[model samples]
Target: MATTDDSFNGLTEYCEDCDLETLHEVSVQIRTESTKEENAQFSREPYRVCECQRCGNRSSQRMNNA
Candidate 1:
C-alpha cells in the first residue's frame, strides 16, 4: 500500500517570497464545492491564494468554473 505522503504532497515554503514569519504571496490549489446541496454542486478546481504567516492575512481569488 502507498503512504499518505505519496498521494498528497505539500510544498513547504516553495516560494522565495515566503520567509520566516513574514508576509508573502504564493499560489496553491484548493478543492471547493459549488453549492451546499450535492445535487446543485458542480466540480472542483484549482484556486490561487495568498497567506501571511505573521499577521495571518489570507485571501482567495474568485472561482473560475470554466
Candidate 2:
C-alpha cells in the first residue's frame, strides 16, 4: 500500500511533541465573534478546535473571513 502527503496540507498542524507539523482533525467549531447584534457591520470570527492525529492533543486557532 502507498500513502500521500497531499491530503494533509491544510489539515495538518504543528505538533510540538512530535517536533513537526502533522495531520490533524477538526474537533469542533466555535464562533468567537457574536453576530447577534445584527448591526450594519457585523463580523464573525471562528475558532477551529483541532486535535492532533498522533497524540490526541487539542489546540485552537482563530480564523477570520477574508
Candidate 3:
C-alpha cells in the first residue's frame, strides 16, 4: 500500500502561499472498510492526504488503479 507521502510526490506544484515550494514530508494513514455498494469488486486501496509545509494548505490525491 502507498503512504500519504508517496502520493505527495505526485503533486506537481505548490500553493500560491507556499514558501518552500515543495510538498511536506508527513504521512497520514486512514483505514476503513468499504460497503459492497462502494466497491462491488471488493477492491481495496489506500487514500492519501497531504498538507503544505509553509502555508498549511491541504489536499488529497487518489492512487491510480494500476
Off by over 4 Å in 1: 1-22, 34-42, 63-65
Q: Candidate 3, which segments miss by more than 4 Å at Cα?
A: 1-13, 17-20, 28-43
Index of the highest-lDDT prediction: 2
Clashes of 1: 0
Residues 1-66, candidate 2: write the lDDT tens digits: 112367753477677877777777775464536546775245555676777788888877777657
lDDT of 3: 0.55
lDDT of 3 by residue, 1-66 (tens): 222444536443456666444655445554444667667446555556767765788766656445
lDDT of 1 by residue, 1-66 (tens): 111222223222323344343434557676655666674335566787766544556666656757
Ranking by lDDT: 2, 3, 1
Candidate 1 to truth, TM: 0.41
Poorest 10 consecutive residues by lDDT, candidate 3: 1-10
- Looking at model 1, which ten-residue stretch has the lowest summed lDDT? 1-10
Q: Would you list the clashing residue pairs of candidate 1?
A: none
Candidate 3 lDDT at 65 equals 46
